[model samples]
Structure formats: C-alpha cells, structure tokens
Target: MPLSSAPISAPIARQGDGADPYAWLQARDEAEVLDYLKAENAWQEQQLADQAGLRETLFQEIKARILETDLSLPSPWGPYLYYTRTTAGDEYPRHYRCPRPVDGSHEADEAREQLLLDPNELADGGFLSLGAFSISPDHQRLAYSLDTSGEEVYRLFVKDLDSGQIHSLPFEDCDGSMTWANDSQTLFFAELDDTHRPYKLYRHRLGEEAAHEVFCEPDGRFFLSCLRSSSERQLILQLGSKTTGEVWVLDAEQPQQPFTCLAPRVEGHEYDVDHGLLEGVWTWFIRSNQDGINFALYHAPQTDHSVPTRADWQPLVAHSDTVMLDGVTFNARAITLSLREGGLPVIEVRPQGLPAYRVQLPDAAYSLYVQDSLEFDSDRIRLRYQSLNRPAQVRQLLLDSGEQRVLKQTPVLGEFDADAYVSQRLWATAADGTQVPISLVMRRDRQGLPAPLYLYGYGAYGASLDPWFSHARLSLLDRGVAFAIAHVRGGGELGEAWYRAGKQEHKHNTFDDFIACAEHLIAQGVTRAEQLVISGGSAGGLLIGAVLNQRPELFKAAIAEVPFVDVLNTMLDPDLPLTVTEYDEWGNPQEPEVHARIKGYAPYENVRAQAYPATLVIAGYNDSRVQYWEAAKWVAKLRTHKTDDNLLLLKTELDAGHGGMSGRYQGLRDVALEYGFVFKVLGLAL
Candidate 1:
C-alpha cells in the first residue's frame, strides 16, 4: 500500500487569534475531512497488516472463553417472568417473557415463552441499538426505541404482544427514553434538539398519528428525561445540567394535566426523586447535595400530591464526610442505599423497623451495582458484584432476615481459575501530597517480579474507575502482563472532595495524579518505564493525552479510544454536542481566566517537539459526544511536532460511533485489534 507523501502542516494562527490549524477537520461531513480520515485508516491498516493473524487468534480466544448460549435469571414483573437469552453465534440477545406460575415459582415455562424483541431480527442487516425497552402497564404492548446510525438519535416503536403486530411511531430524533402513563395508552418521551441535546418532552397516545408537545426546556444548558414513578402513580420529568437541576411530576392517571415543579433549579444544588411506601404513607425519597458535598437523604409525605420544596424534606440519612450517597432504591418494606466510602462501594439496607446494616463483601477492592427492583412490594433487593479477579456475580438480599444468596456467577469456560490471580489495593502519593488509590490485578505466579503493566484511568465527571473483571484482559495477565486502575482525584472514588480537586481550574490535578501513579509503580519495582502501557477512552482519553505530553518517557505505549484531545477548541464552540452543558465541568471558556487555564493543559494545544512513545489512537466516525475530529486533529498535530520514529497510528471506525461496533462478536474483534497493537509494540506478537 502506498502512503500519502503530503507533509502534515500546522494550521496558521493570526496574532492573538488562538485559532487552530486543524480546525478544518471539524467539518466531519465535508469531503476533505472524510478523505483524511480514510487515508489515516488505510495507513493504520497497512502498518498493522503483519499482525492480522495474531488479531484473529486473540478474537477467537476471547470468544471461546465466553459462554455462547446463556440465559439470565428471570425477574418477575407484573404477571410475567421476564429474562433475556442469547443463542450460539447470535450477535444480540432475545428478550422473552412467560406467565408467572400459579404456585409463585421463580422458574418460567419454556414452552410458553413470548419473544418481546430480538435485536438481530430488528437490525435487518443494519446497525441497530435498543436504547429504551419499556412495557405498558397492562403488558399488552411494548414500547422500544432504536438507533440505527449509532448517532444516538432514536426512533420509537410499539409492538402488540398479543396480536403479534408492530407499530412505528412518527416521533424522530428522540433521546430513546420513554415512560408510560397509568392508562397504558399514553406515552411520554423526550426529543433532542438540533445540537443533539434532549430538551423537549412529548406525549403520544396509542394509535395516535401525532404526539403533543408537553414541555420544552428553553435553556440550552439543561437536558430533559421522563420516567414513570416506581409506584406507578406519577410521571416524572427530570431537567438537569452539569451542576444544577429540577424535577416535575404529573399524575399518571391524568395524562392530560400539566406537570408541576417539585423544586426550582438552584445553581450548585442537585437532587433526584423516587417514590415509595414508607410507614404506610406514600413518601418521596429525595437525594440532595444542598447540605453536604456527599449528599443527604430526605423524605416527605405525598400529601395532596403537591410538589414539596426542600424546606419540607425531613432528613432520613444524615450527610457523612466519609461516605458518598450514590443512590437509593425503594420498596414497600425497606430502602437500599448505594454508598461509596474509602474508595469501595457498600450496600446499606434500612428495613422498616430495624437499624441500617451494610452488606458484607469478600474483596478488598470491588464494585457493587444495584439492579432494578421489578416489583415494588418485594422483600428482596438484587445487586451485581465483581472485583479485579472475580467474575460478575448476581446476589439477592432478603430485607427482613438480612440474608444474602448468590443467584449466579458469569461462567468463564476453558482453563480459567480465579484463585490463580491476585488482587491488591495500593496507594500512590500525588504531587500535592494526595494519596491516590490504585487497584492492581496480576497472575499469582508472576507476583513480586518485574513485568509489563497496563494502567487504565478515567478521571472526569465524578465517574469512578472501579475494579471490574474482564475476560479479555485475562489474555494479558496470562502473558505475564499486569493490569491496574488509578483512582485519581478527578473521580468520585474518595467522595465529592476528590472530584472537586480534579475539575475546573483544578483540572491539571487529573494529569498530575495519573503521572504520580505511573511513577509509583516504577519506583515500587512493579514495572519498568519501558514496560508500561497506559490506556483510556473519551474523557479518560483526555487523561492519557495530557500525561503522554507531560511525561512521554514514562510509558512505552499508549492507546486512546475516541479521545477528547482538542479540549480548548471544542470547549470554545458551544454549538458542539455536550460543550454547553459541560461548562460546570471544564468551566465556561467564555471567561478569560478559564480559557487561559484550559489552553494551558489542552492536549492538542500542548503538542510540541519531543520524543514520543508508540501510540495507537482509535476513533468512531459518528461519535456525537467526543467528535471524531478531536482525535484526527490531535494525531495530525502530534505527527507534525513529535520528533520520534516510534509508530503512531489512527484507525477510525467508519460505521460506528462513541461505543464502537454494536454486536458482541464485533466488539470482541475491536478489543482484539487493540490488544494486538499492544502486543506488537511490546514485541510479544507471535
């Protein structure tokens, strides 16, 4: 294959203009930008052509380790037991349901299974994602949304379960979230604006030709979403921005009535609402951050169905300086709280007449995600748990007796033993004397020996990089490579204070914290500088790009997937998706001080003449969140400035978006390609 001989030139900037040379790349739909992306894709393919066989082998190994034919535990909803299953070689799962047995058994009758939706069939050989899957109150119709372009714009569809017929709603450019009224015939959904922001709400009745506009959020900074209350009594509309938000509620029985505001939007204050039966009285569980950064739980009676302000809320769970209240789940008998403290997640159960108790886990560093409680009157709460070495295990907790039972642990086929891997929690001191936690996993046989290490991180939007099990990562561990996660200050690992120290004017802390963690690993004799590879995607990709620019010698190789490298330019343009709403996160660039601060650390703006490490950058053509041009422009700038002969490659998925490929097999293949690149760079390729 012949490579382009055109010299990569830097875009000229006029005096005091602060203009970017590669800004032309933002015209994603233009011919010049498309041609450049295609050329970059071809160049990457040719560069890695020798590793084609290795990629295939890796893909096969990953596929073989996964259980091809599997069924999820049936969850009771109304009169049916619903579950999803996948067949051998199928790209997607098929959702099915069966009538609950008269004896109230958990098992569903296989002979009477009713298929709700099969994504493979719905795709019809095209890209299709099920964004929202909702069943009507009567269970006679299923309302779902599909996004075929991978751009996040969804089309609503309704299926008659009993008649075996499908109806396509006329709504377009929806955000793919819908709520059904108590009547079951009326549905509420949110629509996206021209900038891909969900700002409007609509109501459509069954068999209606048009949907009526219910509410519109005039402010561009706020987004809207609709949800049905767990009690099935109210239709709630949530309006939110990065830091402040408000909620509105409508009587489910009166679908035509206007929504009433629960509380006015107050800057820097955030709250979320969920309804439940508390002490024989219908109550609203409101999680608010007004009193403390970690958030506090408050409850109020549902009197006269009037919206209560913060003044009327009574404290249930006081704010704790050490523990962050992640979320709350409610049922008739008790409430389950997802709390994070000391960089680990814990489930606290508060029964009606008993003191709160925390669920015990076996791992030092692990993740616990609260699953949806399908039935509001049940005495059990379900959660999924996983750690660095253990696969995901679903467990059910009996509220009354405080007994917990493991429902299932994902099966990993072939010669895989969890006991062979060791998981550890270590701390790295940052530049400002902050102790950053690092979760590490490695093969027990290779412990205490210097080996290649893959460090992963994402430190933005208060998202924690928790310990998770990955069968694909097993390939690296088996090859004497260790994996670790840097719980830096930008994430919510240590609560709100940690995240506050890493965003806005303090954004540089994220990059500094990541570098400190990398240096700590080297100083502790865990891995040498030449054997370290760092990886992250999206905002995390920003982390990788920043650290690489600051200390390229500390890492041997780097992988950035759909990276948001052109931060200054992107933040300057409010028209871009997520730019306006993210003002509270990265700070509004319109302000002089914020602009100067962001420009100082923006990866694309910071690229300079230096010896860079081997790098692989991946992009999705239709990614709406972090535009593909950011990666394209960053790579172009890096190539123009970096003085290294080390391999630098950019591969764009023309048919995908931010999430990459949609299907299971395709996703695995993408991972294999990434792993193959890492292996080649490390001289471990077969």
Candidate 2:
C-alpha cells in the first residue's frame, strides 16, 4: 500500500472535534494531490489482487444476463418514428428514426430505419455523454449537445439533416436543455455559470451571426430551465432553488416577446406549469406546493396573449394529505399525473369527459417512469415499470379505451426464472417510532441461515429511493446474498413531510432511521451483523458515513461511492457548485446554530478514532457534485485515526465524473469491481 510522504499539517477547515489534518487534499490541481490519488488507486488494486477471477465472473454474469443486440420501442414524432439501437460488442447505443407507416401502424418497418447519431462512432473509444438531443419542429434539422470530458460542460451544435452539414455554436457550457420555437428557426438553450449553475437563457437563430440573451438569473441559489409546453403554444422558463421556484411563460408564436410571470417567487412555494387544452380553452396547468406539503394541480385559462396571474388559477386536483403529486403530464385527450401513495408510485389518468383511475402496478415495491409523448394529442402514453425481481417492461396505455399493451421487456438473455426471486415490503421502527420502509429481494431457496445481505440507501433532497431490477445483482443473489433498500425519512418515499423530517436540523433522523432498519433486519433473522454489507453513493454515501460514525459495529463491510463526507467545509464555501442552493436542504452553516447542527452529523467532522468495518470508497476525480476531495480527505483521516486495522481502500476514476464511466459496458464493469470487493471481504465464492 502507498503512504503519504508529505509532512502532515492542519489547515482552514476546523472540525468540531479538532483541526482537520487532511484539509491539504482540497487543492486538487497540486501534483502531490494527483500523485496521492493515483497511489491510492494502485493500493486498492493490490488490495483486491486475488479477486481478479471473481471480478471477471461477476462481469460475465452481468453481460450474459443482458441482451446485447436490441432496440428500444419506437416513439412517433411529427412525421417520423425515433428510437435507439444497441448492437452487440458496442459500448453505446445508436440513435435512428424511420418514417411512420402510412397504414397508421404504431411501429414502422425496421428496413426503413434511418441513422441519426451513433455515440459509439462519435465517442471513438473515448468518453462522450449526450447532453441534449432535440429535433426541430420542421424535421429538417437536429440540435444536440455533447460533454466530452465528463465535467458536464456541453457544447451545442446544429446539424442540417439533408445537407449533413453540422454547425458548432460558440457556447461551451450548457445545462443540457434545449427547446425550439414554433418557427423552428429560433432555438433556445441555457448556459452554465462559473459555479456550474444554469443561470443564462439564450436564443440562437439558424443562419444568424449572433445569439440573443433572453434572461439571466442573478441569484446564485436559483437556476433556470426552459421547455416548450405540451400545447406548443407557450415557452416556459422556470427559475428554481431547493425550496422555492418561479415560472415564466412566453408566447410561442411571438418568439421575440418577453416572458410574463404567473406568480411571484415565494420563499417556500414551488410550482411547475405546462400548457394544455382544458374544456376546449388553452390553459396553463400547474403543480404547486402552495396549498399543502404534497403538491396540488391548478389550471388557469389563457384566451389570448395576455398572461394569467395567480388570481386566475383554479383548482383542478385538490391536494391530498396522504398522496404526493409528483408530476403532471398534459396531452390533448388526457391529463395524467405521477403520484405516490403509501410509498408506491401511482399513475392517475383523467381522460376527457371520463373519470380518473390509477394504473395498476405488478408489485408492491416497484419503479415507475413515464416517457412523455412527443405528439400532444397522441392517444397513447408510454411508461416503464420494474421491480427488484422483474426486468423493466415498457408498456403503452391507450387513453381512449383504458387499455394497454406491452411494448418491450428488457430481455434477460441468460438462463433465468422470474419465480426464483421474491420481493417483499417490510417496515422497520425508527428510534422515534416512525415506520421506515424497507424493500427486500432474495432468492426463494436459501443455502444457509441468516445469509449475507447487501443493504443500500440514499436519503436526501426529497428524492425517493425506489427499487429497480439490476442484472448485475443476480451475481450476488445467485451466490446466496440478499439485497434490501432502506427507505429512510430523508427520502420523499412517503411524501414531502417525510422528506422534511429527515433534512435540516432533523438530519439525525436519516441516520437513526438507517440504523434502525439494519437492526430490524438483523433481529428478523434476515441477516446477522457479522454478515451484513451496506452501500450508498453520493448523498446516500453521506448517510452511510454518518451511520458508520454513530454505529460502526452494525455491519461487516461497507461501500461509499463519491461520498459528501466533508459537508461542513463544503457548505461553508459558497463558491462551490451547489453550496448556495444546498442551504435550503442543509441550513447555512454560517449561522452558529446551523453550524453546530451540521457539525453534529457532517461525516468528516464526526469521524471518531474508533473501530470501523472493512470499507471501500470510489470517487470520480472530475465530479462537479460532491468533489473528490471529500472522499480523499475522509479516507486519509480514517487511516490516521481509526484504532482497528480493518481494510480500507479508495478507487478514483481518472476520466469520469459523478456518474462514473460513460459507456454501458464500463458501467457494468465498475459494478463488477465493487461487487468483487464485497465478495472478497464477505468470503463469498464467485
């Protein structure tokens, strides 16, 4: 293993316990920092040297389960059908389109498919992430954005489909969002600021020499996002912070006109709007949290170019205390909503003149995602559904007849049986008597008693941690390992109130809830403390870090990927990417009370000189969110302070950012490596 040769010294960051000894790692550009990261990577490779075969087997298992040569369900747009194809041996999918069959068939013939963009060809064995892919309304041109360095600074480009001529735009940084005007000649995009916030909105015309700036959000806490309404009659620009939001709408027909505000910004109010035809009148449908913690749907009719105010807004869907209105989709013939009730997703559809009904799900704890249709009046809506034990299935629902058909089910290629695995929803009692949900999946046949279990969690930003199928997890499940997810309080699984209970000064609930779930799992004979393995990434990594500090002996091994461990220091620095915006989620540490509250659980500040479980942490050197230094400093501090000599390792991806390696193949490989580390520490055979 590599050891730091530089003289240890304290720096600016003052930990609650003492001065941070590893604060020097924050200087990312220093040669010493780079060398240390590389050394740590090499050390991690050596530490898992004997697991090469296990890693390979795990990788192969993951690869075999996935059908390499496949294509996504085609989506109908203007005059063409668009979809993506993934050929065997390719690291990325190829975008393609075909003319819609004149016979009105939902799917066009494969022979008529036209190639659009191939990431595999564009990447040329390097990293490439597509930020935006927008086809103009005229269908004569395509506008897209690319991020080549994984830093998320995308460059915009316009391509003439017929002439095959591509024109590059001058903007080097974008927020990965683009919208076209009714004229199709005017294109709108958002530019990122120095802090990586999408603060500027601009308009660029085809065949024009200059771009015009439309709007600029001066407040660091608020970022901008723009999109065309479903009616294609309104251009919407939304400025949002963590706890507050304000929406502005422009007349799509008059692209040069300024936008009008629907409501003034309120400190605690957040709302989103979309255009639709309500009762034959063009209307703005909004989902707002003004009336209740869970959002409610409201609509305001727009008879002309005159914008409507909050006074014109009328209730459409009343806010419910038990259900959360996650999102709303507007269509010509129907209005669908994404809702959550009892910690499960519910799709509520209100078709014209007909009553509303919730879509039935296959499992109690499954994942649901809606793919908004391009055609506003399309009668069918596409949705993707999956559970821990089931492969993802794409289904199309007919709004007119209340009927649905399966479009595609992600093929599990290798030998597999759906009945082999069982999924259950369980509840764990938190220390404060709150019931925390746990989604579990395990093989029906057990080879041993109280087998090894892999527990995962992420409890921040009101983001619910939903269960979904993972082909790679089969490697562990087939080897007698059970997997579970702790839907703790910080997550919005139950609703906005649940999320509020886990953040800010109440952040301790997130850690306590996680610990409670672990204890409950052990008490129920699902797994023993000595055979349990916990894992989380990003904010969830923060959860794991805090829980480990409070109760390290609860698990056998743990994995923290891109952890936000240095919370105190990061929040204190307002210039960081999300620091200012994060003040709403985690209170501003500038206030003494807030500082003490954060220091109470901010992982890096709270890490003690106590015994810790075998741990492996993975970080991305180029991550804009949760910078690499947090993980590096945390590991360095643990190495110096921990009393036990338990195995501790760090792996940094030199070329990737927060999401890790870009390609699908590389993503699976990363998972295989992480699982190999778990197998090595848990004494499991490949």
Task: Spell out the clash pairs found in candidate 2.
Answer: none
Question: Clashes in model 1: which pairs?
Answer: 11-21
Q: How high is the CA lDDT of each candidate model?
A: 0.89, 0.88
Off by over 4 Å in 2: 1-18
TM-score of each: 0.97, 0.97
lDDT tens per residue, model 2, 274-339 = 998887878889899889999999998886647788888899999999999999888899998999
**Residue 407 displacement in candidate 2 (angstroms):** 1.4
Winning candidate number (lDDT): 1
Residue-by-residue lDDT tens digits, candidate 1, 312-393: 9999999999999998888899888899999988889999988889899898999897875759899887889999999999
User: Least accurate stretch of 10 residues (summed lDDT) in model 1?
Assistant: 7-16
